[model samples]
Target: MERLVNQDASERNAVEGKFGEGKRKYGLDLIRARLQETSETVIALQFLIMNLGRKLRVLFFKFLQNTILSFDN
Candidate 1:
């Protein structure tokens, strides 16, 4: 990564040595990916809920109309 960055960049870029596997670096990436997926799931669930509410409202109105008409008979 450092080598590729230095080639494209006009100024000198500092390169770091090999990083050992540990809880810090790997944990942070995993946390970020999980947060991204959670946000997407929340949005999808919200969309589904909104559609369901609309359908329920339509059904309620239909039932109300049927009740009123039957009472007039």
Candidate 2:
């Protein structure tokens, strides 16, 4: 099912593509731009995940300390 949909989409795009010498160049330019944007987004997400993981670890340790201290009281 997914393959059928993808094939149909490609066929439609092929028909609409500009039939000129610059068409291939334009497509490659768009592809390059999209790849750069995707890479930057992935890097940003990894940074955010690392920060969140650190925060969660600190919180968990604090929680354990509080529980143990309260028990001593």
Candidate 3:
């Protein structure tokens, strides 16, 4: 169905966007590992770093929000 196709495309776009971000921002586009294992490790580590960065950002903002709220009490 057309709806299913649209959904698939949307999902694909989201995934591709993440890949682009990883490559552009995290140096994933410059991977030069020749071995399969090394390549996989590099990819995994890149994603792990990206995920950790996002988590830290979220935690930091939440802490900032709470601190500001406490000041108003």
* Model 2 per-residue lDDT tens digits across residues 1-73: 9999999999888655633322353222333334778856664554566557779999999999999999999
The deviation in Å at residue 67 for candidate 1 is 0.4
Candidate 1: where is the Cα deviation over 4 Å? 1-34
Assess the local accuracy of residue 50 in candidate 1 as a C-alpha lDDT between 0 and 100. Answer: 53
Best by TM-score: 3
What is candidate 1's lDDT per residue for 18-69, written digit by digit as tens? 1122123333223333486885666455456655777999999999999999
Q: Which residue pairs clash in candidate 3?
A: none
Q: For each candidate in the order shown, give its overall lDDT on alpha carbons.
A: 0.56, 0.64, 0.97
- The model with the greater TM-score, 1 or 2, is 2
Question: Where's the lowest-lDDT run of ten residues in candidate 3?
Answer: 23-32
| lDDT order of candidates, top first | 3, 2, 1
Question: Stretches of candidate 2 above 4 Å error?
Answer: 1-34
Predicted structure 3, TM vs. truth: 0.95
Cα lDDT for residue 40, candidate 1 = 64
How would you encode candidate 3's per-residue C-alpha lDDT over 1-73 as one tens digit per residue?
Answer: 9999999999999999999999899999899999999999999999999999999999999999999999999
